[model samples]
Target: MTDSSRPTRIKVIRKSMKASPDQTESLLWGDCLFCTDAAMTDYDWVLVYDEFPRTPVGTIRNETEPLLCPPDQTILITVEPPSIKIYSRAYTSQFGTVLTTHSIRDLPHPGHTLGRGCLEWLYIKPMQEILDQKEFPKTKMLSTICSAKQHTHTMHKKRYDLTRYLADRLPELDWFGHGIREIENKTVAMDDYKYHLCVENHLEPHHWTEKLSDAFVAMTLPFYAGDPLATECFPQESFIPIPLDNPQKALEIIRKAMEDGEYEKRLPAIREARRLVLEKYNMFAQTAAVIHNHRETGTIRPGAMLKGRHVLRKNPLHALRELTDTLAYKIRSRGRRGTGTGA
Candidate 1:
């Protein structure tokens, strides 16, 4: 039996995900040590952050490998949205169980789709330090950060277009991200804003990303879009939803929220949501809870496993279709960039 007082050692398989402090042994949850070192052998459990296609196993970016541990001792978690089938479908042959996070407000479970997890896992330790304070003075009224990404997904295209529209009109808004004026960290800019324009790349049930979480951590109310199911996981009053279809109406809401002191009115709910993000929704905290549950139960049955080699496996026709779509998107994106109208 494992000792009750000792901190559990969890070997995290990054699978070419972003680098973080945990990649080299970091302490968290008061009793958990997470490390991404592939050579480490003395670990109680194996957790795989399965973000595939975009971040496939091995250096070549197309191959995959089996879980380091036996099925029972392994846990696979994917944070991508269901729209990205390539990411969701990658590395399926390696593990029997995968925990999906989109549906759960408190704990992760096996589900049909993968939604977003803490995309800010790389900076959670420092984010927690910033949130530890009780008050943050809002020097600015609103801001937003969006990357100039060209995606084949329709929702992604819409989001990028909307971001361009907002940036042009909202002069008071401090807009910055990839391909814009680069900021070293999101928290620094977020800390000074009263409200943040937090929109998702796609709109699906229970889908949300770090855009919302960053606002909450910095105690800035989010003028949020996407994720109709967000209220189920967070306080309803925590965010003001705007419709992407109507740019004028979205602007009106932002203007009214700022003029009417919406941040002050919603401060209570924002605090609650911030606590949820820090204590319950952060990736490290969620992983720690899973470890605790596994220790208490002393057993975790394997879920589903695919047979044969862990390679990029898909129907030839479907792959061809996707390839064609990507080429079309790239061509259109080039034209938009030439016209100075693309994100």
Candidate 2:
């Protein structure tokens, strides 16, 4: 909030922008965002939506309210993870198009990959110290890191019940690490585990968050139930896919993998996965690239088009269909105990 760095103007609208005499580079950081240490740098225009995933762009932009930035900026670079359509509509909207003179992009991100964010587990070598003390297990089975209190859907409820079942059904499966923020920092609890149930909020198309990151960093094979795009970084050999609908099937996969030493055998792929996460799938690098692109592109183009983007209003019918499909997913989720589950 220094004088040179401060925004010359400010408002709180999903659409519209107020004019400012100073065309200084501006950055807006949301307080409740998933990317705690998100990339923030000097750019002509930068907008960070902390709750982008929580809020739908089209729904919020119905009214022409003024936003928190200078009016008529060359660009309004947004960084966050939401449905692709949300970003598409935002870029094409009247206000979004105007403010985003250079670019109006909805770059979906998987939480901030900042600061050994997930790599802390491997970086600290908690498991190594335990092994040196002759206290760690020679061969561990499956383990999961549960949050203190939060479940997204009814399927989460059913999964919790199943986790309880397996806790007793197989005592060897160590499902610890709830309400232990200290353990999260050092990877003390995760090391030496052969497999990790890397469940995330949902099985999104391109929304794999820290679930896979943590597992890969710790060199543990992940029982993945998040985005399939995660495989883009690490192949199928690196992690196991868990069926969303059937907890029984997920249980079967884990049990089998651990018994036949398949988890142990996947060490090479696990090592490679860790390399990809650290090198390519880094949050700092990704955000820096977006900002760099903004600096390179200077202004907007003709006929409502941002300098590089062609602005066409999203199809009204398509918007309606997307809304209906979302509602359908929720309704069906309510009908069954084990439907549309996330980790």
Candidate 3:
């Protein structure tokens, strides 16, 4: 007998193959009690972060292993872009429901019923703390923080090339990130600039990362690329679109926006977007909303397991792919270290 009035206890299991730095318990669990282990029987709910199955053994003690979650007690969230095949698997039977930008087969994101596009997870402060802050003192006009890493993905290469072109063309544009320079924090680095260039690695519809949102939180208008459907997720006027195919045009647009005082004009919209980021779009807020809904309705069901796929086991093809990718990544790492640049 669980008390419906009490905050639900949630166990957030990381299922993404990529290793991430540890996040605070409050950021990870929101209003819910943070359950450290799925083995803990006292936990009220389990939230699988990106239910991808391609993971090596003994990595974080096989955290990607599938869980036997009851329909009402499990939730899956996919923050990875659809471009990455590893995170694209539909673990229909593994989790109760999913929270993602794109539709996972016929699975409706439980958070969408509350409000759409609240799937993003980031290191964010409380909403009121963000809203109460005075505007950042801008000392620079336009700048960008981009990595120079080259990858097999066409979009990644394009980003690298575009960054080089922009750096060469705009002498005034301050560039940061790996290869060019490193910053302690992106939001802090962006705060001093009136506008920041932020481009997603992949340009898929409804797929956006912290790139644009980070800029908004820094109160910097973004000269953005990728995610044609960005307006569907954020306030339309919060960012200015720069086409990926045209660096020259992007440069011109950046110049014109700064000249026209676009940052100042869009300041209100940017502030609104930041509020949305902290309040609704963040992982904590979204998880809390889902817990609230489940507490009220008590009708959500766990996903149906596919016969052989429901259990976590080694997939031969996936293993071979992982091996190849690992080798490639090691080679890339060595090369990056040798050159002191991702280029």
Candidate 4:
């Protein structure tokens, strides 16, 4: 490598938003993404999400490995949730920091084509709903499932009322998903549904996840409640956007779409969306794009985005209590094993 053309080493880091006060490379998610990793490292960016911060930002340079980039020379990239602070100033003061965000709302996001068997089941709710939009059902729309154990939002009562109304007045749309059902194949099951009720857990910008992507991959229109700026993520015509605030209006749109055979009409656009999503907007693709953008701009665009509270992880006491309970249980179990119950 020539003196002028030596690849700039960019080190990516992740901070535990609600827990750790400092940014470490503990890979929570979406950490390992390669921009240009061929024989020659063109982009020369390293995604160190899961790795144990082995190459921290403030390591002292040794004379033996002078070819290795110094911590200060490398740009420290922090991948964090959009709801939390993008980067910390105290950390950036030591090393150049870049911010990256992910659209992955659910873990191990629903991917793969829906199998022919899952024709009846329209949706999957493995995790509990935080701030969800009302399930807008149509005449023939059935075989839906959700797994929201609880709704913690202040307006949860209103949504519960709506569900009650549907149960009494219209029995068809009253199906609610609760608890976990490990279907044999998610793709096979989800593929059969016409729409996936993909109401996000939150309403903030850039806080999107695979709920929308899962629907697209399965060739089903996502009755989306999250991501108001859907146009920016993918083609607007691809998914059926729903009104988050107005239940009646959202239901009307869903009902009209079902009655008018809108899904069939939107098939062409939906196909295009699937292509775009897999090729460009999928989690890996998006991470690659963020890396490329950062390299081209020589920094995070418009600089660091700092400080925002996560709606779900707002309380620290809960985490502390959980940790305490886990420790206590382990200790008690060990003591019992040492003592011996009878024999």
Tens-place lDDT digits, model 1, residues 79-118: 6644443222334324434566433322223423243454
Q: Please give the range of 10 consecutive residues that has the lowest summed lDDT in model 2.
A: 31-40
lDDT of 3 at 262: 95
**Model 1 C-alpha lDDT versus the unseen true structure:** 0.63
lDDT digits (tens) for residues 198-282 of candidate 4: 6554444454555566666667666776656667767777888776556777677777776787777887877777666555654
Q: Please give, for residues 1-343, the per-residue lDDT of candidate 3 as tens digits.
A: 4675766677666543333333324334445775444233355677666543345422233334333334566766666543343322334344545666553422233333322444543325564566688857898887787777777543667787778898898877889888778876665557679988887776656667777777777888988897777897678999999977788998889888988999889988898887887677766677777776664434333443321222343666645654554354445444332121122
Question: What are the per-model numbers of colliding residue pairs?
Answer: 1, 2, 3, 13
Which candidate leads in lDDT?
A: 1
Model 3 stretches with alpha carbons more than 4 Å out: 15-24, 27-41, 51-61, 64-69, 88-92, 103-132, 295-343
Once fitted onto the true fold, the runs of candidate 1 whose alpha carbons sit more than 4 angstroms away are: 15-23, 51-68, 87-90, 101-118, 121-128, 295-343
Worst 10 residues of 1 by lDDT: 334-343
Candidate 2 TM-score over all chains jointly: 0.53
TM-score result, candidate 4 = 0.49
